[model samples]
Target chain A: MRLSPRTWTLIILAVLIALAPVTFPSAFYFRIGALIFVNGLAVIGLVILFGYAGQISLGHAGFAGIGAYSAALMPMHLGLHPALALFAGAVLSGGLAFLIGRPILRLKGHYLAVATLGFGILVFIVLNNEAQLTGGPDGMAVEDLGLRAVSDALGLGLRTAEVWYWFMGLVLLLGAFLALNLHTSPTGRSLRSLHNSEVAARTLGVDVVRYKLTAFVISAVYASLAGSLQALLNGFVTPDVAGFLHSIEWVTMAVLGGAATVLGAVFGATILTALPQALTVFQEYEHLLLGLIIMLVMIFLPAGLLPSLGKTLRQGESI
Target chain B: MRLKSTLAVSALAMMAANPAAAEIRLGAVLSVTGPASFLGDPELKTLEMLVEEVNAQGGINGEEVVLIHYDDGGDANRARTFATRLVEDDEVAAVIGGSTTGVTMAVAPVFEANEIPFISLAGAVVIINPLNPWVFKTPHTDRMACESIFTDLTARGLSSIGMISGQGGFGTSMREQCIDVAGEYGIEIVADETYGPRDSDMTPQLTSIAATDGVEAVVNAGFGQGPAIVTRNFAQLGIDLPLYQSHGVASDAFIELAGDAAEGVRLPGTALLVADLLAEDDPQHAVVTAYRAAYEDRFEEPVSTFGGYAHDAFWIMAQAIESAGSTDGAAVRDAIEATTGWVGVTGEFNMSPDDHMGLDLSAFRMLEIVDGGWSIID
Candidate 1:
């Protein structure tokens, strides 16, 4: 029986999430696996913002920075649990996106990009300057999410890495599931139509501004949640989390893996996240090789790896 | 497809052929690229050179010393990822590096949890404070640098002081330490101002310091171009007060950036910077001179204090391995803690339970920039 592509995507992701650990030589791979899922979650948000809505956000890492700092500060200052801080950060990020997107999303193309970039730099400066509150650039430790204690209470012994791997895997699945459902929804169709041409979509009775704002708010929440999870996993967060380079990394991850598809974003995140650890074998020449790969990929596959590879495979099947 | 499969096969083979028990693996993660490369590049060269030297001389404790290294690109997440790979997959006996304080702090927990010795090259007290058993650092902590300057100021009877620091982590750390350590030395910080790290002109902050009452000396704490800009601005503004700098600016790059304005500026730094000027009887003189000669001969660049930290880290790890008589992590951790009276390019080392930073104020020497070069004073 032939299945729909979305269903196949979900099935493949679930099976890979469960069975890939069988190849691990040690528990260390679990940490890398968890890192991939955390990064994939963020890139999935990029898939919505950049892939679906066709908007550019060079400063999305700013929302991540807010989420990370919230995870570190809320529990210490407001006497809330780290788990609760995660939701609080997501909510706050969504609210900030709603407020900022109203004005910034009105501008098109590079102007909008610059406005978002300015916002990101502002957040980075605040985090760097507020020495007393945010611990400045030296970074501050975060309270644990207390998952281990709860697992012990339930009589399920698990390593920290294993627990995080499972937790992030579940979160990424939920994120991907939501993103896939949105791919066929009315809002998603409006977003895609506007992405094709704003004037045409507006003529067709689509609410251009509202759809764009919705995409921005939803993507901000995803990025924020990913940042919160990362801070909790590392037990530390720095101003770099919100830096412009990290924002670029998320975008690059989306574009590198075929941003239009959820599976592609996951593939992009996995490769980008794990490639460094794998490249350690190259030592000094790692950067050189990484640059070569990026250059070669962009030059050869303009449509990105996943989409282009899928086209090739389909062509081969026809042949 | 052939090339990809071949690469995978070789990788699998490499993993299958793990190091024998007779081999000891030492891992280093440094920002060999990106913004912090100025610090990490010298460190990477020093470690690469020293690893070859040790391996040439029959390795540490007669076991082949295999160096596993990765470039973190000065990113904290990359540093954390590399640290995990080093401790877990590589099975390194000890890990060294993370060239900046932020990167070091990010990976300290991984090394701590895995029970591996992590000798950081960065200068942050938080890495070892609250006492993580597995982590230690080679550079003098930011708190130590603050106390060193304050001690010199108090000795000179300059009790009233002012400070202008950058907004970076290093600057923030020193600012807090200066304020906290001032009361201990009976000194008063009359003025405190800060500038952004990218600010080319610190004239406003320096002007504020100059206008403060009873300010006997102005100290600038920062790395990169920020401190040099402060010095140039101080000279340009013709501030008459003595200008002090932290050890963060102990390099020829600072002098070049500040031009003649850097003359007569005093700071506390390791003896390695002014090795040739040290007295023959000085305990650190011979070791410092040897290290300076070897590093300059190999890398063909004047030795930096950051490289000296790596030099000390290498010897410290080597000494711990030799003393422990094994490649085991816990054994090496205990051996490093019990380290005493071991001298290196930086200072005489003595590690203890409470004091992971073994060197005291004695490790630092009062240095003055005379005619665009370092001269040991007092």
Candidate 2:
């Protein structure tokens, strides 16, 4: 029996996640692996918004900031569990996205990008100014999720890094699975059709605005959840999570990895996240090398790493 | 193919491990590329220079020193990851730096978890307060800066103060610390104002502060060009009140940015900034002069106080390692905790169970910008 591409993607992701630990020279690799998964989850969400729906957002990191702060603050303020706080942050981000996307998603191209970018800056300003509440720029510490204790009680016998690695890997897999499933759904088809030509999609009875807004809200939730996971993993969150740079990073990861493909987006996340850790040996020249690599890839592969490679391979096979 | 890939992985691991077992490895994570590079670049250079100096002098206790450093790009997440890598992967005896308060705070728990000595180059009270046994910092805290400035203000009989701080992490921290410590020094903050870190002009905040009743002096607590811009604005607005700045702006860059407007602006800074002004027999004079000369000789730039933090961290770690007599992380942590009366480029460090900074208020000197250079004030 031939497996669908979606099934293949899932299988591949699962296998990679399971097999990654075998090559771990030290427990530190687990931390890097978890970071990759966390970043991959955010990029997968961007695939839905930027790739499938063809919407531009330069302020997605604001949602991430909200998610991170929610995880940090909710436990202390509302007496909610850290897990529940993560969920609440996602819901809050979705609500905020829906409200903003209604008007902002109407814009096209760079106008939409600017609007989203302004939203991110506003969030950053608020987080920075509210020193008393959010601890301002010196990010406040977060309470532990008590997962280690629970694991200990259940005799799971896992290290802290190991727990984070498995948890984030599972989260990324679930995110990818949903994103892949969405690619074949009716809403997904409408989004793709609208992306190709908004006027044409509208003429064919597709609700363009609704689909765009839906994608935006869904992507925000994804970013929020990723932010929550990151804060939980690091045990702290700062205003940088909501800064314009972080938003650009997420979008860059999505585009660089083939935004349209779930696996490609994950690949992009892994590379971008892991590249810095790998470049530590370069010391001062790490930024130079990183910039050079990005430039080279963009120059050679205009459609991004995975898409360009896939097309070239397919063409070669056919020839 | 699997066997081949495994072979490659093992080969790479072996290559990473070939730095010789007798070499005492030290690690550092700093924001060497991004906005905080002004602070981190000098720090990285200082640590590298120190290592070379030590190795040149027959190494530390007959073991060559290896410094493994990573650039965190001023991101907290990157700092955390690099801190973990330094602890778990490189297995260094001690870790240093996170050039900004936010990055240092983010990585503090990692060092605490690994039980490795982490000596921060940043100046934030939170990095050491509520003391984590594993973590220590070189630079004076935001509270100390506030205390020093307030002490000066009180001494001048300028009890009523107006404050203008940037909205960055360091700015906000100093603002709060200033407010919190004002009562202890019998000072009253008559007006408190803040401008965004990126704001080119802080005239509005200064104007408002000047307009407030009983505002005797204005204190600006922020790093980078923010405080410099504030100084320019304060001069432009012609607020003749004694202008005080935080140690966060202890660099030549601030003087250049503020131009003639920096004249008469006072700040409490490390002795490294005005090494030549110190008495001939001063404890820190020798270390500061030697470090300044060596750094200028190598980098062809004026010494920054940020590098002095890294210098202190290096000497403290070296002293700890010498006292501990081993490369063990736990031993180094204990030795660092028990550190006392060790003179460094910044000040004489004296660590205890409660106080991790190991430097007193006297570490900071009152400095004024005369002409275009830093001058020590009595």
What overall lDDT goes with each candidate model? Answer: 0.86, 0.87
Candidate 1 lDDT, B220-336, residue by residue in tens? 888789998899999999999889999888877888999999989999888987888899999998889988999999879888888989999999899899999997889998888
- Every model's TM-score: 0.95, 0.94
For residues B34-104, what per-residue lDDT tens digits would candidate 2 score against the true structure? 87898899999999999999999988878889999888888898889888888887888788888988898
| Highest DockQ model number | 2
| True-structure RMSD, every candidate | 2.7, 2.8
lDDT score for candidate 2 against the true structure: 0.87
Best by TM-score: 1
lDDT of 2 at B278: 90
Model 1: colliding residue pairs: none
